[model samples]
Target chain A: MNRVRRNKTAIILFIIPTLILFCTIIIVPIFMDVYYSFFKWNGMTAPEFIGADNYIELFSSKAMGFPRTIKNAFILAGLSVFIQLPISLFMAIVLARGVKWEKFFVALFFTPVLISTVVIGQLWLKMYNPQYGIINSFLRLVGLDNLCRTWLGDGRTALPAVFVPILWQYIGYHMLLLYAGVKSIPEELNEAAKIDGANSWQIARLITIPNLKPTLQVCTIFAITGSLKAFDLIYVLTGGGPAHASEVPSTLMVDMIFGRSRYGIGSTIAVFIIFLCFFFAVLIKKVFKTEVD
Target chain B: MHGKIGKGIGNKVIFVFLCIWALVQIFPIYWMFTFSLKDNSEIFGKNMIGLPHVWRWSNYIDALKVGNIGRYFLNSVFVTVATIMITTICALLATYALTRMEWKGQKLANSLIMLGLTVPIHAAILPVFIVLKKFHMTNSYWALIIPYAAFALAMAILICESFIEGVPRELEEAACIDGCGVYGIFVRIIIPMMRPCLSTVAIFTFLQAWNELMFAVTFISDSKFRTLPVGIQTLCGSYTTDWGPIGAALVIATFPTLLIYCFMSEKIQESMAAGAVKG
Candidate 1:
């Protein structure tokens, strides 16, 4: 009886603080978000119970502008997979192999990961400055002055321009992860393939790529979730600029909450963002399980 | 054989490609520092990469004055330290329980932590905001500190759990036999043994809190309460097309991370690799 009591006390002492913090920060807020999604409140005023009106407006109201942000997120997700994934994979493979001064090179590639997104966003904002930014200046020097555009100021180029810095920052991180994965593969496998007259490309395709499935799945899920939730870089770069050209759901929700003071609408957006993250997370987990099976 | 020569050439080609890619990686940061040293006119000049005509060291001074950079720095320090303290203690206890204790719902607790790994911050922001408002905690330290701790707990626990599992069960048994209770065993035996993993979690937690912008921007409206990232964003908006002070602020912001990376690159790499593998 005394031993049981002691064990109970230990468990209580261990779990209580964590439970309190998580409940307050995560569990309770999630429930609040669900509740707020059905209301009409501007944060300061009393919330009016509107029974799915917010979500209904979110789906149907072209003026509320959730679809555009969703579209931008989808485009960002696609570009991340199509452009960032391959480049990072190639860089990881090259960096992971027999090379002199590997550490220095790895650090060089990984530098961007250490930078805050706000700084990256601001730096790129200056970089893409139409008047005197380095990009345009270089274009003029190379006699391609006509190619220069107001990258962030233009509605057409805003999304692509903002994506560059995000891609730059994350590619190195992905490369580092993939490099670790690639390095874990036994060197003897490569040696055997080479001895059997397998070409370098064949070895990479058959052995290296197959072996990197787990890493790839991880990277893909991270990319998808990150792209969907991307806020800081976009917030800093253009504030979803040149008229909401690069608005992501998170940024849009932020604008609604802080900018417009529409807390309930913002919560609705937040709920949708959560749903999206959960959806992708579940899909990835399912895919990983199936691969294991 | 031609095959050997071809392979050697291929290796050299790969090396060259990687070096070029490295240049692309470093160029923006290199440009940032150079631009910071230059005056406003030179910053917007046609020759973007040229040496500064006059190195105005006062660009940093001016940026500091204009941005209230000192207050922002203090705010970041306070929030980051509080987050680290809360997260480290809570995560250590939870991780100890999950890994060492024979709890009935250990599986459920573990899954809860794992679920946190995928719960995007945006998902919880609305509810968190409302709850904070209800408690009149908005714009207070609790607003940022609590969420930062919660968000980081999953990562901290994951890394610590892996490290704790590697610790031998015999040590705990011996400590218990010596009349050390569960808490005592954790303090004297587990924590000391888990230093590397603890350091790894600390580094990641610090970086996450330090660089975080979204929540800071959303939660804190007062300028004096704003963290570094939010402060920098405000500076960018006010400075608009003026690249000189903006670049200076960015350089100042990036300096700490650069200094840490310069000295601790290998450790950071190893920790990150370990975390990725376990994750």
Candidate 2:
């Protein structure tokens, strides 16, 4: 056993490959993002350092639309927390009440989470097609033809149109998380509540909701950060299009780097996203901790 | 008697509501399949949600032949398989080392690996592209495989660490007493015990790599190396008027994930819940 413990070669062989890959792919890139954020360069030219200008332009330049993207992301994060999480909580509570086909419903709802975002985007794109889409067709069928508009085409409806699939896709993910939380609450508590003349609603409000705070906190963080990092569905759905009406930080970063070849500003957005995720994670944890205390 | 009747009615209403929600969840997928088989005219005018009347399986063939979905499908399979194999092996050995073996800086290594979780892949795109370009690895299979495996390691290791810790040390002690070396013990004792954890990691890694679009689109511009998600996106662009082929492409791209969900959903759900709790 001691000979095995002292075998340094075995340990190095086991750890080094993963360690190198992890660093190259995750850690080194993060530092490089910060370093690149300070420079001004297109991809073809040598980078020139212009410390703080990129950050200044990002915040102050109205034309750049950086603040608008942040506002868009905040809207998404707000919707995830307010709208998405509540639906998930409601479903979780109902399913956790030992309903029939509980496992079946959970799996059904989780189906969307497993599919590719590109596919979801394509599905919704066809759904929102003004001429042939099922959404408009159903609307027209119901004698509400006036209510149908160009969903992904117009600026007014495009943002909400893009946000719907993003919110809809993850309902099951948060539900599953909260369902596990709801299931983990000992059955004894619910049974005791029922015996004490408590109704279903009463048990849910007093016992179930109170005990779900930890899972709710985790769900909230995932929702918020997930919104912050949202790119794929939006990219495929609208390409942040109809004149950047639906731009988030990610799409904007991709456009800046790949579309416009401004690696410096792109890296700035990348670093900003990283910082925002960490900030919100710590902030949510602190907030949840204080509430628990 | 009145109260009992009302309670029964309420339960029925809740049941109906749950069924409606299930329909909402599953309807788009059903729509995808239906439209995939219809021509553009029927899809647009005659049949919205109904099954295709003619059943034009040729849309799928066109997606394969003209849209180059077959090529992209192979690319996705190769990348996903390589990613799963690499991530599974690396995460297994690394988890063993991080959890069981005694060494200096193990704590640092463990924390650093875990730190990979909170780091968003979006943030790493630029620098990684630059580094890969420097080495001329861009537009190659290694380009996607390397980053996909690297990013997957943190969660894989986390999942593996929890499972590996549960394996009894007595088995390893017995193996050692029989003069088995370190590699021998790892190969014989630990690897066999890790089958469930390996599959969990494999499925998780498989989904990420299979569905990944941003890197597939960015790192590899060559159509030869394009993946399924990127291929579907391209199909959508080129087949705008002929959305049937795009639908067919989407259905093709989505079949594997749906298959996984059909078979191993419970395991995936459990792994996700466990990962969330630990994270």
Candidate 3:
């Protein structure tokens, strides 16, 4: 009995510090966000009591409303699922199939994943620089100078321009994940499929694709959530500028809270972003029936 | 014989396609280095993608001296090291306890940690900022260091637990029978055995700290204390674009990470592959 008590005390000593830190950093902040969502304050002065006004404004088409930001997030989410996933999966399949100098190629592809978002934003910004950028220079050299418009500065292309870098940085990461998934499949399965007269494409489509469902589900969740929470790259690239064309929820929230000093609205946006992420996460989980064993 | 020919052709096509894709992947980094070495005129010259007219090595020198690149580099190094130290130690201890110690609330503890994974750092920015202000930690190393450690705990704990699960408990039992205490056993027997995972944690923590931006922007106010990402932002002006120096500064900022990635690419790839499979 004495030994049991002693062991319990040791466990408490071990666990308490991490538990306290987690509660302070995570749990409290979530509740605070929910609470602050109900009020209206600029964070500089007093918070005015405004019940459900922030949320009601969420659905309304007011300037700095939540609906538009959510719409942008949805669009990004769609791009991630449809565009990013397919291309990254294709790359993963190709890369996994015994390329020469595999290590060098893997390193080259994964380099962007290790770079800072700010640098990537800056690099892409310069790459899209209208006059001196390689993109425009190549266009001119190929006799298509008329087609080269200001990529990031133009409103129509700003969101897509932002999406390109995010896609570029993360496609390698997803590819690596999918490659791991492909490798985990038993080699015997591939050999058996080959014995049954299956070609490479046939084996991959029929065997590899079906078995990669769990990995695909996880990758999809990460991509979707990552797209919705996208901020630093977009913020650095354009600061949601060229007339707020690339305004994600996180950026809009930061602008309101820090730039505009509207705390309550910022909190409302934060709360909304949380809900959106949770909604999508839960929706994906339900669709895929993802469960931890 | 026909089937063999077709298969050979298909492999050749795959090889060519991957080679082109590899070029696309590496082109931007190549452009960054090439542009950094060029003068302003060459940067805007007609042969933009061609060889630089002059290899202006002094641009790097100017970037180091004039652009405060040295200061930003030092700041990033300091912050990254401090964050890695705190996170690695805290995560190692906490994960060891969770996995090996006879804890009463192990399940609840694990569930709470899992909850931390879903709580995105952005959602907590406001309250954390308010808390930091209350403690007068804003603009201090404590501001960045504390938050970096806190936010990283979920991933560290997850990775560490996975590693510790694979460690043989027999070694710990042997160490205990030889009069080693729990702490001693952990230090001597367990930690040395978990070097690969520890290095994996260290590298990941370093990369995360090095690449972080939003928190630094939000929490830091002083120019001297700003890390590379935020410092690079101030290099740009409202109207004018200093293409030469900005590109140079970016090259200086990015070189360390690139070098590390080159050397440690295999290990990083292995760890990431392991993470994906385990997940």
Best by the TM-score measure: 2
Cα-based TM-score, every candidate: 0.96, 0.98, 0.95
Relative to the true structure, how large is the alpha-carbon lDDT of every model?
0.84, 0.92, 0.81
Model 2 chain B: lowest-lDDT 10 consecutive positions = B1-10
Q: On residues B1-279, what C-alpha lDDT tens digit does candidate 1 reach at each position?
A: 447788789888888988888889988888888898887777776446877878877888888898787788888889998999888889888887787777688899889888788788777777777777788777877789889999988888889888888899888888877888777787898889988787788788888999998788878888878888988988887877667777888888889888988999988877776666666
Is 1 or 3 the stronger prediction by DockQ? 1
lDDT of 3 by residue, A11-73 (tens): 676677677778888778889999988888876678888999887876784676566667778
TM-score sort, best first: 2, 1, 3
How would you class the docking of model 1? medium
Give a tens-digit lDDT track for model 3, residues B1-279: 339889788878888888898888778888888888887788786446666778888888877777788998999999999888877777787887788876567888888887676667788889888888878888887788777887877777888899888898787777777877766776798778877787777777887899898889988889878899888877754313557778788888899988887777888877766654444
Q: Score the docking of each candidate (DockQ).
A: 0.64, 0.76, 0.57
What residue runs in model 3 are displaced by over 4 Å at the alpha carbon?
A1-6, A290-293, B238-240, B276-279
**DockQ class, candidate 2:** medium
TM-score (0 to 1) of chain B, per candidate?
Answer: 0.95, 0.96, 0.94
Deviation (Å) of A34 in candidate 1: 1.0
lDDT of 1 at A275: 90
